[model samples]
Target: MSIERAFVTQPVPFADALGVLRAAAEESRLRILALLSEGELSVSDLTDILGQSQPRISRHLKLLVEAGLIERHREGAWAFFRLCEGRAGLVDPLIAGLDRQAPPLSEDQARREAVRAQRADAAQSFFARLAPKWDQLRSLHVPETAVEAAVLDVLGPRPVHSLIDLGTGTGRMLALLAPRAGRATGLDSSHAMLSVARANLERLGLARVDLRQGDIHAPPFGRGSFDLVVVHQVLHYLDDPARALREAARLVAPGGRLLVVDFAPHELEFLRESQAHRRLGFAAEQVAGWLADAGLGAVETRDLAPTAQAEHQLTVTLWLAAEALVAAGAERAVA
Candidate 1:
């Protein structure tokens, strides 16, 4: 990513100035900008919050988009609206200067909070239905900040040409490690999860990321590419975990490293029945052998176990493997 520059808020010419002002002059349209500044919202979400008809909400959105005050993107079957960077610069300062304690806007802010609460409830229900035990196991581990810090420590400060995150749920790994690479891609199988990842990426302004829906067992990528490949907490969900590892290994460029993160060996049979996890965890030898079978050289492994104060804990293991620098031209790990 490049350096951020300040917004140059110059006045608009005579002809378009009126149009821009008119777009924000309406009661409904002004509130739209206020809500969007918080996060992207769908037409349905706006309709629900404003207690307005779909046609009326869509009409206001059309005017806002025409005025360049906001932008729209279609993901899967839903269209989401968010504030544009350049245009938002012109509007946000004025919005921030407004008396937020005013009558109608104060009430609108209350409604917005209610909408966000409802959305959070729905997201929790969705995840619980999909992987209850996995969520439970997540609580048993050491705090996530420590795990992410260890992952960063393992990945030295050297910059990379490209990186890929397999099973990139919520795009956290790509977001976490993207600064170390020139470009990064995140692949996932679920559309619902991809939508969540897309929103997070757009919110953070990480424009260099490319996302696609694909199976980890047969990733859609060129052979011997990607300076780094990551399989983070994905194997537990798959039936043929080795096949996915082999596929991930195939994408590692020569001299490149493959990082795998997952729970260490554990007696969590409940995960299989409740969370749809096919494997409880992996042994150091189990994953090391997989890397060897996939033609990657074993490097090192680290186990970050919880402290004595923490009961019902799961030890997280991280394994780093590499493709020999001389073997980039070799055929051992090619797709």
Candidate 2:
């Protein structure tokens, strides 16, 4: 008589909950929450810390507030947001779950973070001085048309699904390859250069491009991530060009290619001191050796004839190398 049927309720679907949670899981939103946990911060405080526009930060904060995860307090002219008490009950467990799944930051990440900080500072100073005359400064380098044509010629008729442009100064190479590739990533150590690159890409209405602050010798990208890797006019600036070449090769996917365009052997003492050139120029043989050491083969080097004569008389050379997985494996076995 006491054994009446007991009712049970089904658990909530994690997929639905995750959908809601993911909306708040964005980089800017998460950063805002983490910083607010310390104490109240004005929009300006967030702007400086996150290096984003005030409107951008405000929008993210509004999303969090609307999500019931944070509450905002107005103190005079300033508005600050704080984590909601009961919301932490939801957020804490969620974060703990994520913590367990997250991997520890690697050494490369640490080094990149440091370099990013330095570049940010340097970029601010560099651009502050150069912004007024950026057009003139850019003119000192090769023309956009010529640079674009050179890159396209080297690319040839090959189908490129993914590409990485090392030292993507002003995103010139990224722009040229963006239409052909499914994804294009640009890496450079100078934040100033990346800033210009990002602006250029944005102006061209290209959104599927990623730019990272990193050195050529030790790129931030994962190994073997790109089907086509390019290093244009960047090798001579690095202290270790050979290591940089190897890193470029490492990023090449099997059956993919690496294209390098830089100056061949030439004397430019002024560039060496003024522009921080590591070497006057690289020899084709030297480049071949580096590519060979990196397990790449079928190297082809071409010296592009200059269209006009100038004071520098720079000799532009294009080196094309391929990384075939089957051939590489055979070589490894023989060794």
Candidate 3:
């Protein structure tokens, strides 16, 4: 292979490279690699797509995992597999060499689309059922366009290296900000919501972004993992918004930022009962205090109030905070 076309990672030893090629040499394993090149899929998904037995597909996956050609992550009882990013230098060229429009590969692509289409249909039905309730709440606030514009303005025009959306409902923020992010991930406690997000992202061809079933208060990522962290329209549902902010802030890298979007203080009692809201809208000072306690500095706030024509609507607030670079330095110094 030409040097320019090779994978851009630490050079692999000849022996290890041979092992990867050996594991991927088989016909079925080659097809699996091609399928996963599109997105992550479960064992069941592979069986359905390839029209193969579960045990047969599982065995191939095991070899691929051991060979470091693929990686697997478990969610509940099910596990999903994808091409190992670390192995991209080796695997990418192999998949790229495949003639996708050829017989077996083309057939595999058709079956894969069918599987994803089924998932999309199911997720759409679930969202359709809840759409009315969401629409009702949306009407009670300033338009989403206004809030999104304010959010964009607050974050500025620079693209971030990495971003995580805490409680990413339907993956809206992930999709919106994805163009500006080199890597993006969304975490939510609800598996159903994640399913919806997965389908939505797939339709948008954003298969590169990762989605996981995880809690916002205790996210699975390591400290200082992302350049930007966002908590949008989620704090009102939590009993301890401050604790959640602290956890989200922990993931912000040095010199990174955290952006929060939610409703300002309001006397909306019905929201508590009907919407399962744990708290009414938050006050500006209340959120700033939480951000400060979380070791975030240079806090900036913006409020988007309902227009005069919509007097009864709720006001949406945006809070952008910078990671305390001085605090991070001092801690490292002490350590």
Candidate 4:
């Protein structure tokens, strides 16, 4: 689509169109937009790739954000910028028109790859340092492939409109289910973990998946904002698993569902000391009661235990619960 056709079909207000054109009219800002079209990037990433000062890059980002040509997400001390969904018609066409192989655009692509390579290397180092502990835990479960397949089976063939994965480590769950959802988001408290997730998702061309660095205890979203909510292998690390479940339940829209994947009750005390697990595991009734307290109903639990030969290992449990649609409807009616 051409830039003119984008504005003509979308029919943005005249002032808005002018602002967008002004934002992209600049040479440096245009390059930034091209780089962002590939994936989300921080100001530092753009600065390094464009070889411009931090202040200059930030100024350009601010202008694009204000013009609605891009959007910014602040995660702790760092902020990431990406193409704005509302203005994609305008931005995508403009980026598509770029002569990618010519002049400064070619140089920018090379630098972008170098920056991404460094990011991947740093994320790999972090994972490498913890791989032994992670590997030990994995060995105690049914193979992850089996657990993932079970999760899919539990979800069935229903299409998800919007999904959020709490404590999204490595973004594996988001990648697994995103293709079946209209939009996907992943949240983790650890910035390092989010970086690892970002690299993994981007490599798989799932760059549009929103990755936010946030606490599971207090997710940064309004109640009932998502059609589906997932809490995978995260409850064990929390001091209060029930509280996290309540929070996860709060995000489920009316008629939507929550999926919890974790280990069943176990005597894995060593996990507390070695892996910093706050809780060993949870029982079926224990989690069901929590979901009920959160106003979710129709709870179901499935267990996937290690093979008979590996009985000493932990049993992975999957819990599915639905938001109380009648209650939600009544509340809406009352309001």
Candidate 4 or 1, higher TM-score: 4
RMSD of each: 8.0, 14.7, 4.3, 4.4
Per-prediction TM-score to the true structure, in the order listed: 0.62, 0.61, 0.93, 0.90
lDDT of 2 by residue, 88-116 (tens): 54565554444322423132234334544
Full-model lDDT for every candidate: 0.79, 0.69, 0.88, 0.87
lDDT by residue (1-335, candidate 4, tens digit) is 10111123476788888889988999999999888888789999999999999999999998988888888888889999988778876677778988999979999999998998899898999989989999999988899899999999999998788899999998899879887787788999989999998887777778778888888999999999898999999999998889999999999998899999999988979999999999889899999999999999878799998777774489999999988885467568989
- Give per-residue CA lDDT, model 1, range 83-125, as digits (tens): 7666745677767776668856777777876766665565556
Ranking by lDDT: 3, 4, 1, 2
lDDT per residue for candidate 3 within 1-335, as digits (tens), equals 01111234788899999999999999999999999888889999999999999999999999999999888876677788977778888889889999999979999999999999999999999999989889889989988888888989999997688889999989999878876787788999887888899899888888767787788989999999998999999999999999999999999998899999998988889988778888888999999999999999778899998779774479999999889994466568989
lDDT for model 3, please. 0.88
Compared with the true structure, model 1 gives a TM-score of 0.62
Q: Which stretches of candidate 3 lie over 4 Å from their true place?
A: 1-8, 326-335
The better candidate by TM-score, 3 or 4, is: 3
For model 4 the local lDDT of residue 283 reads: 91
Model 1 per-residue lDDT at 300: 77
Which candidate comes out best when scored by TM-score? Answer: 3
The list of candidate 1 runs beyond 4 A from truth reads 1-135, 326-335
